[model samples]
Target: MSTERPRIVIAGGGLAGLSLSLALKQALGDAIEVAMCDPALKRDPHGDKRAYAIAASARRMLETLHIWDAVADKAQPIRDMVITDSRLQDPVRPTFLTFAGEVEEGEPFAHMVAGGDLTAALVESCRNAGVALMPTSVETFSAHPGGIDVVTNGGGITLRACLLVAADGARSRLREQAGISWISWPYRQSAIVATILHARDHEGRAVEHFLPAGPFAILPLKPETLPDGRIQHRSSIVWTERSEEVPHLLDAHTEDLLDELERRFGLQLGELSFETKPQAFPLSFGVARRFTAERLALLGDAAHVIHPIAGQGLNLGLHDAAALAEIVVEALRLGRDPGSADVLDDYERARRADITAMGLMTDGLNRLFSNDALPVRLVRDLGLGLVDRMPGLKKFFIREAAGLAGGTAPRLLRGEAL
Candidate 1:
C-alpha cells in the first residue's frame, strides 16, 4: 500500500542484533532503514574476555556480509575434536568419541573467535554500512496499525518502525512487554569461562571432558607469539560445575584455582596459567512460546537460551539472523510489509524446528552426562562409541554441527548473496 521504505528497530547490539543489522542493510541498501539500540555498544568491546565457536554456516553468513575477513586472521580453525567421559580422580580418561572437524574438503566445521574481536568488527561493519547505531537501549514499545513506536530510555528518543526485534538476550524486557511467554528452568550449574595460556600448542584441536559435574570444554584458539619469541598456545575454557560450588572456585586463590584446573586439564598442553580472570555464568534452558507477535519478532537469546554443552548457542542465533534477513529482504522486494504476520510467520516456521531440536538435544546431553550414575554413564559412552564408529552418522553430525545439513538453510548461510 505504501511505497515508503520499511524501518526496522533492533533492541540489542550483541552479536545477533549487530549481524542482523548488517545483513539487512547490506542486502537492501537504502531500501530499508535499520537501527540498533544497546547501551553496551557505547563501551569498548575489548573488555569482553569471551570466545565463541563459529559454525561453518554462520561463518559463511559473516563472509556474505563481508565481516569475516576482518577477524579471519585471528580465528582459530578447529581441525579436530575429542570427547571423553571420566571422573576427576581417574588416572586416565578414555576418549569415547573423536571428530575430524571438517564438514567439507578443506573446510573445518567451526572456528574459535574472540568475542571482543567479532563484536568490534560487526559494530564497525554496521556503522560503515549506514545502519543507525543508537547508544541507548529500547526501554519500551507499542505496536500500532501502521508500525511500531519505540521509546529509548535515557536518550528520550521515540522512533517509529515497521518492525521491532527483541535481541535483548535471555532476560528480554521487550519479549515480556510483547506478552510473549517464556518457559525456562535453571540447570543449577554454572560454567566458568576463561582463557588459558599453555606451554605447548593445542594443534587446533578442541576437547570436551564429560565429568560427573558437567562438560568441561577446552576450545582451541590461535597461538600468540610473545615478545621473547616464545609461542604461547591458548584455549578458551568452559568448565561447568555445580552452581553452589562456583563461588568458592572463583574466590579461590590463584594457586588453588590453578590446581583445580590442572586436575581436569591434564598435562597434555604443558603448564597452564590464566590469561584472563575466570567468570562464571549460571546455565539455563529457555524458549519463547512464540517467536513473533504482530510486528514484533524475537532473535537470539531473546527467543531461546540453550545450554552451551554443544557450543551451538551462538550458531543458533546467527542462523536466526540469516533466515530472518532472507525472509524480510524477499518480502520487501516483493512490495509486501516486511513486518507483516505472514513474513514473521515464515521466519518462525523456518527456525522453530531447528531451535527446538537443538534445545532438547543439549538439555538431554547435559542431563545424561552431568551425573555419576553408572548405568547412564555406560549407556551414553556406548552410544558415543557406536556413533563414533559409524562414519556416515558422524559425517551427518558434522554437517549438522556446521549448520549446513538442513534443506532450509538460508542463502547467506549457504554463502550466497541475498
Candidate 2:
C-alpha cells in the first residue's frame, strides 16, 4: 500500500458532512486527510427558517468537537415535551402523552437550536480541525474498489482513500452515482416553519401538539432579535399541512398565516406573530437500501430521513458520522484499508437496524395521526394516555428522546467530546 494517509472526500457541507469531518479529525488525529465539498451557498444563517431538536447524546458530541461552547448560548434546553390531541371538545384535555426528563442520560430530553446556528457552528469547527472545505459544488463522482474520484465544479480531484461519504442529504446525488438505492415516498405534506415571538415565555419547554391536520411542534430557542431591532422570544414551528395547501399558505398574508398557526397553537402562547418569514419544506421519508458500497459510505440524511415528529433526524445522522468515523479510525489503526469492503460492512451492520427502526417509527406516527378513523384514533389516544399515566414507561421515552438509549453511542454524544 502507498504509505500516505488515506484521503476522505465528503460531498455535502451540511450538518452531516462537516460533522463527520470534525469527528474524523478528532478520532484519527493526523492520520487522515479530509476534504468536504459543498456549494457554500450564501445565506444569512441568522435569518434561517429551520430549527432542530438536539438530543443529549448529540450535544455531547458537539462538546467533544469543541463546537458546543461556540453556540451554547443560542440553544434552549427542552426541559419537557408535552404531546396531546389538540381537538378535544374542551381543548384542555389531559395530554395524550408527555415526555420529560434529564437532558442527558440523566439530562433534559433535548435542546432546541436554529438549524442555521448549528450549521454555522459545525462549519466553524471544521475550519478549526484543519478540514479543507471546498466552496465549490460536487457535480459528479466515481467510486472504485480502491478509491473514489470526485469531479467538482471547482476542479477534478482523485480522492485516493479508504472511503468516500455521501452526506449530501435526502436527495443525495452521490448515493445515486454510487448506485445505492433507497426506499422512499413522499409524505404528501409540507411542514410550515418559522420563528414565532410567543405571547409567553417558553420556560424551556417543547410541545408536540397533535392537531387535526398534523403535528404542531413548538420548540424553544434562545431569545433573539428581528431585523427591525426588536428583541424576540422565539420558538420554532413545524406545522405539517396537506401538500395541496402549501403554496396557498406560503402566498397568504402574514396575518392570514398567523391566524391558521394560532388556532393550532391555542392560547397557551397567547397571541402569536411571525418573527421571520414562514418557511415550508416538502416532507418525506427516504431510507437507503444500502449504506456502504465498495469504498463509499452514507451518513445523515444520505442514509435515512425519518419523520420530524420524533425530532431524531439530525441526531441519527450525527450518530452515523460518529460510528463511521470510529470504524474508519479503527481500520486504519489495524493497518487495514479504511475503504476495505469488510470495514465498510462493519459500518453498515452497526447503523442499519437503528436507522431502519427510526424510519418505521416516524412513518408509523405520521400514519397514526394523519387519519381520523375512530378506532385508530381511540387506540392511539388511549395509548398516549396510558404512557402518560405510566411514569416508568414515560421515562423510557425520555431516554430515547435524549438519544442515549441505543447501541454503543459515540463518545462525543456521551457528553465527552471526540
Candidate 3:
C-alpha cells in the first residue's frame, strides 16, 4: 500500500484559510498533508482593529478545534440587540426591532471578537497542529490533469498539491485565474470602522441605528480596567456613509470626525474617545458564478462578499470553510480523490443555496434601507415593525442569526465529531 498522504494547499491565511487548516488537522490528523502560505507571516496581527460577531455555529466549530479558549477573555457575548430607524437629524430614533440573542438560557447567540485576536489564535493553533505554514506569497499556479503546481514569489519554490483552495480576499488572483465569473456591484456606500473607549458600560448590548445614509452599529467589546479599579468600556463601530463622502469623513481632523460620530452615537454611552484611527472600506455585494473550478475551490471572500449591514459576511465565509473541510475529509476517508469532480460538485451544491440566499438578502436590505426616499423608508420601517411583532418569526430570525436556520446542521456546528 502506498504510504503517501494526499496533499492540499490553501492560499491566503486569513480567517477562512486558517480555520479550514485547523479543521482538517483535527479531523484527518496525519492521514492528510496540508500546507498554507501567505505573505503576511512577518506582520503583527494586532494592527487589525476590526472585530467580528461570531455566530453560535462558528463558535461551536472553533470550540471543537480548541481555539475559542485563547480568545474568550477578549470576546464579549452579545446578550441583546436593538434596532432603530429614523432620519439622520430626526428628534427621535425610534426602536423598530429588538432581539434577545440567546438561543438557549445562559448562552449568547453570538460573540464579538477582534479580528487581530482571532487571527492570532488561528495562526498559533495552525502552528501547533503541524500544518506547514509557508511565509511566501503565491506568485502563480497552473492546474494540470490531476494536480496543481504552485510557485511562491519570494523563493520561487514550486510545490504540488492534489487540491488548491483560495481563501484570498475579495480580489482573488487564483479565482480570476480559474476563470470563475463574479456578479458584483458597488453600493455607492462605504463604512467607517473604529474602536472607541466610552464612559458607561455596554452591558453586552449591541445597537444598530438605521439612518438615511446606512446602518450604524455599535458592538460592545470586553471591558478594560485601570489600575485604580475603574472599568473602561469600549465598542466597535461600523458606520456607513455615502461613498462620495467617505474620503472627506476619513480625512477630516480627529475632533471633526468625532463631532460627526457624536451626532449618530447619541449620549447613551457618555463621552467617547478613539482607540484607533478610523478606517473606511467601500461596500459591495458579490458572488462567484460557481464556487469550484477544476481542482480548485473558492472560500470566504473569494466565493462571496456581502454588505456589513447584516454582520454575516465573515460567518458566511466560516460556513464555507466548515463545509469544504467536511466534504474533503469525507472524500479522503472513502479513498477517493478529494478534488475529484464528484467531491467538488458536492461541496458546491452544499454551499450554493445558502450563499446565494444570503447574498440576495443582504443586497435587498442595503437597497431597502440605505436611502432617504420617503416611500421606501416608510415601507421598510413598517416591515421592521411587522417582523418585530411576530414572536415565532422573530425566534426564527434569531436562529438564522445563530447560524442554525437551514437543514441538517454541520457536525462541527452541532459541536459533534465528524
By lDDT, the best candidate is: 1
* CA shift of 335, model 3, Å: 0.2
Against the true structure, candidate 2 reaches a TM-score of 0.93
**Candidate 1 off by > 4 Å:** none
Instruction: List model 3 lDDT by residue over 1-418, tens digit each.
Output: 1346788999999998999998998899899888998988768866677989999999998898899999999899999999998887898889999999798787799999999999999998899998999887777888887788988887898888888998888999989989999999998899999999999999999999988889999999999888999998999999999989999988898899899999999889999889988989999988999999888999999999999988999999888989999999898888888888889999999999999899888888877787788888889899999999998999899889989886877788887766
Best candidate, TM-score-wise?
1
Model 3: weakest 10-residue lDDT segment is 1-10
RMSD of each: 0.9, 2.3, 1.3
**lDDT value for candidate 1?**
0.93
Error of 2 at 133 (Å): 1.1
Candidate 3 Cα misplacement greater than 4 A, ranges: 1-3
Q: lDDT ranking from best to worst? A: 1, 3, 2
Predicted candidate 2 versus true structure: per-residue lDDT over 1-418, tens digit per residue: 4588778888887786778898888777787889887776344435455778888888878887888898788888887778877562444745777666484354666888777888887777777788987777777766666676777776665455557787888888888888888898998888888888876788887888776577888888888667999767778888888879889988988888778787777778677888778878889998989998878888898889877888898889888988887787778878988887888899999899888888899899898887777787798898888888997777777887788775777666676543
Candidate 3 backbone collisions, by pair: none
Superposed Cα deviation of residue 292, candidate 1 (Å): 0.7
314-337 in candidate 1: lDDT tens per residue? 999999999999999999989899
